[model samples]
Target chain A: MSHDHDHDDHHHHHDNHFSPMEARVRALETILTQKGLIDPKAIDAIVETYETKIGPRNGARVVAKAWAEPDFADWLKHDATAAIASLGYTGRQGEHMRAVFNDAETHNLVVCTLCSCYPWSVLGLPPVWYKAPAYRSRAVIDPRGVLAEFGVTLPEGRKIRVWDSTAELRYLVVPERPAGTDGLDQEALADLVTRDAMIGTGLALEPEAEA
Target chain B: MSRCETLADSPGLPVSAEGEPVFAEPWQAQAFAMTVRLHEQGVFTWAQWAEVLSREVHRPGRAVDGADYFDCWVTALSSLLSERGVASEAEQSALSDRWARAAEATPHGMPILLDNAG
Candidate 1:
């Protein structure tokens, strides 16, 4: 798309308070408007689509598919992009994914220390901590340490793996789906895949259901 | 972290690599810092990054907006790893092929582009 609008980049200079990307977003929006490539109606549609339908819905599908088929689950773990596409629900970051499965033997978490490199196609935008430097620098070195701070305790003698998502390829931590989901169909299982579960911050759906 | 430091505290002001004080503009410094950070994290080597960056530079009418900034960044990272033997040629080719297939099916034209470039 061509950005042809006469944007006031000077507006950002008055306070010098906008992040470069933030500034660029604003400038691009103006340009899009001028070029008639986008309008207020399109912006609303875009935001509404992302906020209501895309991110969370794709996440649920991934969780459900994993719970239903073991072979599919293995494929997801090794090659998340193709695995997700197999279900016809691949999103943006899921285009290049490496799904890390968390279990009693190992736990996986994600962080974008440098920037918020999240797989928005499946999980949407990142939460605050994913972009925080504290989480990023610390997650790689001491995953167990970070999990403890998050109030999650790893089983004794279990190893913790932290995957750092990048601008090109991103990761998703597939927390073990709760056991009670055994008979649930793909639709029902998808409900269990919360945003937190996809981010590796929270476990799969189940508070009281025991393993 | 320094980039985050600059983002949170100073917003528009850029910080030096040593975390020293300076007044580099946000986009310029962030673009520069992200390049540096990727290097520090072993995402890619400087030489390989420079090669892909030159391609964007040769393309006309790209400097005005930030559209190409992150796009170039990610492409450089992908290329750098392939060039340096960090990612095997097979792995690189597989990833590229997968990305192409996914892009075709993408209703919105490659969601990854929106994630990184948006």
Candidate 2:
């Protein structure tokens, strides 16, 4: 099949300007497409999937469900991959999973010191800070300080644990269930769970805050 | 807030505003999708991708602030493709040169097509 014009619309409207990297990526894509090794449509679909369909909302639902159901929480704690998959949130970057629960005395934070190995199927693409070198190195060197940068400050006595994610394993920080959220249902609770909450950079919104 | 503002607000740690685009640039997302798509198509295993990507990221003299993250991604992808015999480095470089020429030839507001090289 002729590869010409296959990715015509994929080009950004940049007044015919292309950065060196952009040109390189385009060239690589063109070569790959011409060789029939990859389909431009497949690339578009993948990008679209991550951009719209897959995101933190899925993780929020998982966290909300865990907070609502004790059994589910147990499952998430034990076997996160299966537990998260059962919720229909399973894909690349999240093949192996571990759910680190945040409690009154212990708070869990996640960072990939090597690279950004975030739980994409659940928490969506990692936030910029999650991939920033400063955050990656500092999250391990000074966990509390990193949290403070995100405006999160745990009580002095509370223990902070930083989980380093790798390609083989990814962690999801299930932020502590906010108070007065008992009356709220899973859907409402999910709303309280922000993207950063699951990444341990922020907390779940309190019932009052959400209201 | 705009990306510029976000960068300025947190120079060291650029925190994206709520509802900000997942990728800072379209090309970044495109590079990311291409890698994932290639893996899904069985061109390379996830482990292989991770190995190459990790090596690229950890290479000495690389930007410590992660600004060259996607550059690493492109380099890793090219090496992987070369290793897998999908595309040789020479072939990729030649095609990249063609793309550079095509991009220069294409008029403003028009898509840069490979055919433009000719």
Candidate 3:
């Protein structure tokens, strides 16, 4: 299915700024469009999809929700597809969902060996390393080493579970809620959930880290 | 904890229950969208594009790095454009050189202004 056409208050900010990568993108866009190879409008829609529609914010919300309610967390673990869709984050490429939880004894990490199939509705897009051949290869072969590379040091004796996602089933890691968040609400908790945490590369941020 | 259960994609109009390929870099997304839009516009059929892309990735002397997926995609598109007569190889190569020179000459934090940019 094509992207939904809600086109809400998406900010079309024009700061006349383009990073080196952005400049290269602009050059490609111009070159391709001028040669009648690509339509500017199609690029606009695709850009908007990743830029605003699907992103870490969506997954953060889901993580926060899981932390806020044990019943909801159970729903996420038992029936992630329905649990996630119930939150209104459904669309193309994000219909089937599976969420793995972090506990004192088990850690979950996601990787797609064949291709970078991700939960676009929640995580938006994966980080570069997730799609790298090394990551896809090593996540299964050497999960602990890969985690260490990301500065994540799991406790000794803790078993790491890696999820190899495919085009059929997708995964979102429900990171453990950080300590010292006693009075924090769902929104505040969401703020503490980083993309890396949801991907099992990092932990829920320390409370003091919240700005 | 173990790997999540693998499921087969639902048969349908390509929407399926699962997600599509996610782009890590913005350039990858742009390259992907450009290819998709071009296909939709009939610049070349998906079958033709797929065939050329398979050839490009499998071409002689290509790097074995998997991180080059989008890079390979872009190169394949360039090859397709040249092969289909929509753009010339020399012209695209010249354009690429022009940008590299302009980018090198531009100062930090300023726009890369090409003299011939339209």
Candidate 4:
């Protein structure tokens, strides 16, 4: 098979060479700096929040709280945005996100088939693969097969439903509360709640079993 | 977070003579990057992405509002890149200036210019 597929003439190489988004960002920075849109302190605040106090760790807290308090979990299921903000873990994409609780019978997985629409406020930006054509295409058709690629194996008889997220609604998967987490404090429970569990790819880490 | 607000208020148009508008907004790139990263991580297959993206590109009214295949391509880029914090405004400006300088330095007829909007 001759795989020298070079139909480059048909391509709009200009757009590809220098990313438009990068341009926009650069232009915005120039204008902002010129117009004094950025306060020196604002940059500090943004960097500090992202580096020190945000991301999966905060998401873990949300998960831990959900695990410990039934009422909170109920609220999360009903109104994820309010529930998240209530815990002071709110951000841009998470403003109006929804949480899908996965279980043994019905396992929910998320993908932005068209684009990477995620609950960034809670989970931060998704890792690169979430946006790839492979994941978007395969997740809907063969979730179990895709999960296996991520090293996830579901027990037999579990039905998986893939949810497509949009700008209006983002998502988090409230993984089934881990075993040995019974009566654990929020902090301890948070430790068990990992980014993978929040994404619904893997279960929350439970305490090790006795020898 | 509020970087978008700054860009929204700026001026001087979107792109240069040779520069093409890939994404309508900066966040779109971040979104696009996030999606691409997820795919790389093997959360799903490229086939799935192709199917969904084709549908998105062909969605009703998208074609009529001057939206064509290229727009879909750009939209795809926007969605993926937006999630990755692809680039910032100042950085893009520097790159554009560099490209312009390179274009100017290139011998006549050696460099081709496409996507000239005006």
- Report every candidate's CA lDDT: 0.54, 0.75, 0.69, 0.55
Q: Model 2 - which docking category?
A: incorrect
lDDT of 4 by residue, B1-118 (tens): 3333322322211322333223333244333333343455454445555545565576777755542444454444334333234444345456445544443333321321222211
lDDT of 3 by residue, B23-56 (tens): 5555667776776677667788766877777776
Deviation in Å, model 3, residue B60 alpha carbon: 44
> In candidate 3, which residue pairs clash?
A93-B19, A96-B17
TM-scores of all predicted structures: 0.48, 0.53, 0.53, 0.51
Top DockQ prediction, candidate number: 2
Cα RMSD of all models vs. native, in order, equals 20.2, 19.3, 19.2, 18.4
Q: What is the lDDT, from 0 to 100, of the residue A133 in candidate 3?
A: 70
User: Which portion of correct inter-chain contacts appears in model 1?
Assistant: 0.01
Best by lDDT: 2
Candidate DockQ values, in order, are 0.02, 0.17, 0.09, 0.04
Deviating ranges (above 4 Å) for candidate 4? A1-55, A113-116, A209-211, B1-118
The lDDT-based order of candidates, best leading, equals: 2, 3, 4, 1
* Stretches of candidate 2 exceeding 4 Å from the true structure: A1-55, A113-116, B1-118
Better of 1 and 2 by lDDT: 2
TM-score of chain B of each: 0.38, 0.79, 0.73, 0.37
Query: Per-residue lDDT for A70-142 in model 1, tens only?
Result: 9989889777888887767555322377788888898778776433345656775444345456776777777
Which of 1 and 4 is the better model by TM-score? Answer: 4
Question: Candidate 3 docking: what grade?
Answer: incorrect
Question: How many angstroms is residue B28 displaced in model 2 relative to the true structure, after the best TM-score fit?
Answer: 6.8
Q: Candidate 1, overall lDDT?
A: 0.54
